[model samples]
Target: MMLTKEEERALSGEYGEALSQAMRILVKVGEVLGAERLVPISHAHASGVSYATIGEPGVHWLESLVKGGAKVSVYSTVNPIGFDPYSDIIKVDENFVKGQIRILEAFEKMGFDTSLTCTPYYLREPKPFERLAWGESSAVIYANTVLGAFTNREGGPVAVAAAIAGKIYEAGLQVLENRRTDSRIRLGFRPTDAAEWSAVGYAIGERIGQGIPRLEVPPPPRDHLKYMLAASAASGGLAMMVIEGVTPPKTYLLGEEEKVEIGREDVEHMFGSVEDADLVFHGCPHASLKELVELDNLIKEKVEKEVWVAVAPRLYERANDVIKSLSKKGVKFVRGTCLVVSPIDKMGIRKVATTSAKTYFYLKRRGLDVWLVRLRDVASA
Candidate 1:
């Protein structure tokens, strides 16, 4: 493999042992995936270092890294840490406040510009033509497809590795060949809304697994496109997949034109039912403020037994006032937690409902009755 002087320098322990070690791994990831070279990223986000998400081990590691006084070579924002309104669950009880504060202090000391939001693309936009290696799966899809930025769904460790190395692959999504549509699946329904894209993305994900698909569907059904991709990724273990028509693949159609059949039954099998749903989850891939504002209205009309909605940190604070007004109703607005990863069953929650096909499958896997319903119906019910 060839190396730029900076790459060779970074590999030679010029950036410290941890960063050097991180670069080696990123190089390996690049090699395995056949990436040509590491591209510079203007802005990036790292996931899985959340104190709340990974529990004790994660928290301890952050503390240690902070104390070690490591340096991050590039500018990056990050997912949430500790308790915030965006997350429904916060790991305050697990860690000593002193330790938690120390970790934050260390990040500050190390000059890591951290913003406690998972969906950093919402916070700070990554422009088209800029290449980034981001961790959070939904964020990667949003950047790749919606914003036309280039990124792969690099995992948490890899994001750290890339950040340390100050580079990630300039190839993959950056290249024309890899970005071309590999297969095609015409949708049965035309999604007139972007929210429904999550379902369509999920349905196609079920059919094609992790491969790219030229999805011919309208962008309707609701709000938030990443929800569908997240649902698909969660069910199928696909970190990142492409929607050819919607993403940056407009001119191309499945590379020489090939047709693939997706059985309605196959897409339907990934979901259960939403008939008597007891819970509604908004943040599979983290809901935007638009979804939260919509949920606020849904709260008034819902008037159900118990409905909890999670939003991003910034959005959660805004919804807090609205939540107070709906005290009489069975609606609760929370954040920093999601139904797919949180403990809903312990809350005496059986029978769940979601517009997200992703959450429906996860809930069903946990032995709960899950209904895959539309968001409009979910708000009314």
Candidate 2:
């Protein structure tokens, strides 16, 4: 792979050991992926922040980068951590809290925004054709498909490296020619809400298995589209998709695609009954402010069940009025964390009811019986 003089110097250790290591990692990754050269990126979002997911080794790696003088060269953000530091409702081991705090400090020392969200696009909306080095499967696919940005599904360390170097290996979705899709899906039914859209996305992912597809359905609301993209990425590792009027023209191509029809029945099986759920949760990708307001409106009376909603800290702060109103109605708003990465099992939450397929997928893998419900039903579940 070819490198500019500055890149070469950085790789050779003239730019400090931390930057040299970061450059080496990017160069090695690019070479392995057949990237011809490194390209500049506008932004980066690193995942793997949850202490429950990465444990001590991840913490050590981040601390090592901080010790080596690593600092971000571009605007960068981070994914959700293990749990909300301010929430007293959710309980976990003291050791876990300490580990989470160490990880947070490392990110802060390295100049990352520490947004603590899977949906960094909500924090900083990328323009069309903007290049990003982002982790978190859902965010990668959303940036590529919905926002018309260029980014592959980056790993946690790779994204952090890209932030430090301000460059990424130009391969995968970064190259326009590779964005062409030869698979098409026709949706016979319009999804009513986020949960149904999530089910449709899960079904599409199950069928396509990482293959990008052109959707024939009308563009749903942005909030619903968010859940669909998140579910597809979670289930199928999908990085991009083309929706006729939604995805920006010239950013994607449709070939002689094999057509498949998807209807209501196809996604019916994806929704599970919410009868015995110990906890009702929402916001796997973290709820947007609009969604929070909608949740507030949907619950007409105080909820009888334990209801938890996850949201980005920034959004949570902005929705103070909505949060207080919902709080009176028995809604607990958890900032900067979600059920997927938090130690809910340790908190005695066995069966979960959520409106997100991505949450359903991860929690079920952790031995909890997860149920998929509609957005309106979540408040009452």
Candidate 3:
């Protein structure tokens, strides 16, 4: 792979050891991926932040980078941690809290925003063709498909490196020719709610696997689109899906792809009832402010069952009044964390019902009985 003089100097340790190490990682990755050269990125979002996800080794790695003088060269943010430091709704051990704090401190020391969200696009909307180095699966797909930004499905460490280097390889989704789809998905029925949207996405992912698909459907609402994108990425390892009218023209190309149709019956069975759930959760991607407000409007009085809503700390602060009102109505706001990353099994949350298929996918793998439900049903229950 070819490197500019500045990149060569950084890789040769002319910069601090931390930056040299970061540059080395990127160059190795670029070579392995057949990248010809490195390109500058506008933003970077690193994942694997949750204490439950990474444990002690991950914490030590971040601390090592920080100690090596690693600092972001571009605007960067981090994924959700194990739990919200500000909220007491989720119970965790003292060790867990201590480990989580250490992880957050390391990222902060390295100049990351510590946004604690999988949905960095919500924090800063990327423009069309903007270059980014984002780690989260859902966020990668969303940025590529919906926002028309250029990025690969980067790993946690690589994303952190990209933040330090302000550059990624000119390969994968960063190359426009690689954005073409060879598969197509046609929705036979319209999704009525967020749950249905998620179900559809999950089904599409299962059918297509990692293949990018051209979606034949009307443009979905922004919130619903997020649910679908999150579920698809969770279920299928999808990095991009070109919507019929939603995706920006010239960003993606449709080929003579094999077609698959999904009907209402195909997805309806995915939505399980909420009758026997121990906990009702929402926001696997972290709820947007609009979603939080909609949830507030859905519940008229205090709910009888335990209901938790995960949101980014910034969004939680912005919608403080709405969150407080929802709290009075028995809605617990989990700031900066979601069921997928939080230690829910340790909390004895066995039977989980949520509006996100992505949440259902992860929690089920953790030996919990997870089911999908509509947002209204979650609020009412």
**TM-scores for candidates 1 onward, in order:** 0.81, 0.98, 0.98
Model 2 ranges with Cα > 4 A deviation: none
**Backbone clashes in model 2:** 0
Model 3 residue 371 CA deviation in Å: 0.7
Clashes of 1: 20
Error (Å) of candidate 1 at residue 132 is 1.3
Mark the regions of model 1 whose C-alpha exceeds 4 Å error after superposition: 50-57, 80-114, 192-196, 219-224, 237-245, 248-254, 262-275, 297-302, 318-330, 346-348
Clashing pairs in 2: none
True-vs-predicted CA distance for residue 149, candidate 2, Å? 0.5
Clashes of each: 20, 0, 0
Better of 1 and 2 by TM-score: 2
lDDT of 2 by residue, 211-291 (tens): 789998788888998999999998887999999878988888777798888889988876765567788888978898889
| Candidate 3 TM-score, true structure as reference | 0.98
